[model samples]
Target chain A: MKALKALSTSVGSKYLVALTGLSLVGFLTAHLAGNLLILLGPEKFNGYGHALISNPLVIPAELGLIGLLLLHIFKALRHVLLGRTARPQAYTRKVWAGAPSRKSWGSTTMLVSGIILLVFLVSHIATLKFGADYPSAEPGVRDLYRLVVEVFHSPGIVAFYVVAMVVIGLHLRHGISSAFQSLGLMTPGWTASILAIGLWLSVILAGGFALIPVWVYLFL
Target chain B: MKVHLKVWRQTGPDATGRLVDYTAENIAPDMSFLEMLDSVNETLIARGEDPIAFDSDCREGICGTCGVMVDGRPHGPDSCTTVCQLHMRRYNDGDTIVIEPWQALAFPLIKDLVVDRGAFDTIIQAGGYTSVNTGGAPDANAILIPKTVADEAMDAAVCIGCGACVAACKNASAALFTSAKITQLSLLPQGQAEASTRVVEMVDAMDAAGFGGCSNEGECEAVCPKGISLKHIATMNREYRKAMFANR
Candidate 1:
């Protein structure tokens, strides 16, 4: 516990945030790629989804993913709260020096948007991954791809998912660069490369995930 | 070039302040911004008006003394340079320039375009130094700091205590300034003996002096005449964390 406290207090906490963020980035990419299987039509996509959830390794991975997400949110909230408490006066003047870096806006507002993302994630999983506790015509006949298409076909749900994907894109943009820096992988030349990679990864994940909803609403 | 200057005027520390407008005619484009101010002062002195009081010592960019909010930007429109080094060429003719002293609770207005930044000195005094004895200067090569470490320390050491970082910060945070000094000393082996003590005392002093906390904004680096990095702030946080646990 003392070690945990020490870890929490040190720059280690930043590492924790960075590592968890990277994990989420990886998860997003994998999730998006799997969802992209929907392009092959419902049978292949639903089979992939069934296989993923039924896999022996997935249960523990799911637990770990949950832990990682919670940890990231917890630490981010703590840091934001600590920073806020440390400075009571809101900025009223334009700073000419010592401005916050022009990194991704998502990274800066991660705490606020992370909460929104968390809510969206819960509702999304409850709707598709874990069926809502309501009686349906087909009870627990978990066809995730169909469920995804169905939910996205609704205008409100499509709008919500689109907004959530934007937030996710933002989160990944900052998180990618920040994660590399926190892990001590940032070199002068490598910094730009790493940031570029992070940007590409974010775009693909966000774009891919977002395309699913848009496709379902328009074409599918 | 002729320019109109709206300068903040406070007679003394206790007096209320107002902006006074003045015009300088036929100013040289190559003249440093301070030189233009000097020309205005010379004309004012000839007229027997108490020449608009301002602080400046080394006309050179170093020494960190010549600071003013020039036209809403610290050290004028130029990026990564001090006011004394800012030349008149950056502005066009007939420009209406607004100048003000550094405004912060910790930095009190002493007079027109001059704020008493003695709070910085006090904050430094609270801890900005290593407990080294005054003797013959140690051989530079004896330290053997890795080139990377030396480079990083030098980067942090470039902070001139100009309070530009504070002025540029929307929150008026001194974290960059404080962290730069803390990192400068804490990096070298010579300063290692007092590292833990130095970080704790300095951070406490900075907080006690009523400066805002850093929000990781990189504005300080942008306007810093020396281009000091905010990585030093991260270093300072690391040092402070170490001190808290190790000292305990």
Candidate 2:
């Protein structure tokens, strides 16, 4: 109870958000790695998917990810409320303090991008995880590779994934470095590198995931 | 030079405020921003109208007393300078400046361009000071603080508590101000005694004061009159984490 109370304070809650956010980043990296196996053909992809699904630890890991996602959303929503109440009156004409200031379109639009990603997350799980489960030639191993190719074959679904990946990119563009600052890991010497990491990580993950679908639609 | 102005006008705390237009003519380029306002107020007083109200004590930048949203940027566009130190030379002759008070629920409006910054005092009261008793003044070099450490502490110490950080923050958060106070004390030997309690209590006080959470966007550091770095914020976070674990 004491820990809960401490972590719930405005500053403390930020620690929670940063930790959970970065943990989710870790999850994305692994997910993206697994996703890239699609380029190696159906046999390799299906076997990898089967191994992951067969692992008893996968269920608990999925549960943990869900918990982290929900907590991140909860604390973020609370911040939105606090932000509203902090300034009952609004500025008449607010302008961005340019240069040396880190404020950006990505920083300001965090909440919007976050919400869009949340909606995409739901539809993504529905389409990929719970869609048709065809059995592979190897008994008991689901043909997950076929499902991915079929889904991406549709131009509409491919376009949706591309748009969703762009939103993810924008979200992480601000989120990665913001997480370090919140966790107190940032320093003047490392600030530039950390900022670069945020930008490049977002691009890599977004572009990498977006590539798989476009590749499958065009070549596979 | 002459300039047009749209300044926020409010009679009292509860009164609805609006941007009332005024013009200052024949102003010298070297006149400070406040001096231009002073000239405008002179015309209003001569016309038997209520002159605009603002706060200023020690027209020098060190006092942290004078500040206003000049053209939406805190303390005007100059970096590491206060509103009082900002000069009219930075503006074009016919430029229009819109001025507003530091708007935050924690800092209530007292007049047109002044808000009560007593919440900052409350945060200081919480734990911004060192409680250790030093027997009179010690020798100048007794503490033996490293030069780099002293310089960093002084950097954090330069925060004028002008509330520009809060005004510039999208969430109106006091994290930068609170962190600066925490960082200055935590870096010194005398400050070690209450370090843990200081961080925990001050952060709690900051939250109780109804300030918002930090978004780590660096706007606060940018608009700070003293250019207090956001590194102090990171230091504060580290201190808070250590304190929470240590106390538990």
Candidate 3:
């Protein structure tokens, strides 16, 4: 109860949001690495996928990831609601307090991008993880590579995936540095580097993920 | 010089307000923003109309008594300057300047361009002081404070309690203001005794005042008249986290 009370404050809620958000970013990094294994051909990709799902710890990790995502959403939604009430009246002619202020399209539209990503996440899991399960030639290991290839074969899905990745990039553009600030890890000496990393990391991760579907749609 | 003014006019807190336009004429470029408003108010009074209401004191910018959303930016377009100190030269003739009160739930609009910053006072009263008592002023050498620590403390202490940070924030968060207070006290030897209780109580008071959470956008830091760095906010967060665990 004490911890919960401590975490419910404006400062504490932000701390939790930052912690969960950065954890999700960590999960994304691992996920992207795993997804990129598709480039190694079916044997390598399927073997990797099979190895991952077959591990006993996989289910617990997946559940933990789900818990983290839910908590992130809960805290983020609470923030948006609180923001609305904080300034009951809107400014008639608000302007961005330009540079040195990190206000951006990404920062402003984080809620929108996040909501979009949530919808994309559900559709993504349904199509790939819970979609058609074709048997592998080696047996036991579901042909996840085939499922991925088949999914990417659709132009509509490939286009959608690319668009979703862009939204993810938009979320991360502000999220990375923001998380550090929320966690109190940001300092004058490290602020500039953190900002740069937030921008480049978002681009690298989103662009890297986006390339996969495009590469599959074209070459595979 | 002349400029077009679209100033917010509200009779009371519950009254619906709107921007009423008036032309400010015969304005000198050297005049401060508040002085220009004085010229406009003079004209309105001469015309037997209610003059635009705003707040100002110590027009030199130290009192932190004057501020308004001038053309959508708090304290006008200048950086590290308050509204009372913002010069009219920043504007061109015929420029349409829109002024509005600080719009935050914690800062209720009391008139045309003045909001009650009582929430800040409430936060301060919660824990912005040290309980240490001394009967007389001690010699400067009595406290062997490091120059860097003293400088850092002074930097945080420069915050004039202006609510511009809240006005500039998208979330209308009081983090910058509260953080400045927390950091200034936490860094000093006198502040060490109550450090844990101070951060916890002040932060709780800030949240209870209906201020939103910080998004770390740095808009507050950018708009701050005293150039209060966002580092103080980081320092505050560290203090808060430490207080939570230590006090527990």
Note the chain A TM-score of all models in turn.
Answer: 0.87, 0.97, 0.98
Task: List, residue by residue over A1-220, the lDDT tens digit for candidate 1.
Answer: 1446434642446667878988888888788788889889877876786678668999899999999988988876765665554334232224333243543466567766777888989988887877533332344435666666677779998988989998888877777876766544654557569878988888888888888888889988
Residue-level lDDT of model 3, residues B6-33, one tens digit each, is 9999999999999999999999999999
Docking class of 2: medium
| Cα lDDT tens digits for candidate 2, A101-157 | 788778888899999999999999999899999999999999998999899999999
Q: Interface Cα RMSD for all candidates? A: 5.5, 1.5, 1.3
RMSD of each: 5.0, 1.3, 1.1
Per-residue alpha-carbon lDDT of candidate 3 for residues A18-134, written as tens digits (9 for 90 to 100): 999999999899889999999989999999989999999999999999999999999998998998899999999889988678888889999999999999999999998899999
Highest lDDT among the candidates is held by which one? 3
Q: For all candidates in order, state the fraction of native interface contacts they contain.
A: 0.14, 0.73, 0.80
Put down candidate 1 lDDT per residue, B1-248, tens digits, no spaces.
99998888889888877788999988999999889999999999999999988889998988999899886667877777899998889889999888887777778777888877887898799888878789999887876889998888898888888998787665567878888899889888877898877876776677667666554446667878888876677677667657756844
DockQ of 1: 0.15
State the displacement of the C-alpha of residue A10, model 3, in Å, after optimal TM-score superposition: 0.6
User: Each candidate's chain B TM-score?
Assistant: 0.95, 0.97, 0.98
What are the DockQ scores of the candidates, in order? 0.15, 0.73, 0.78
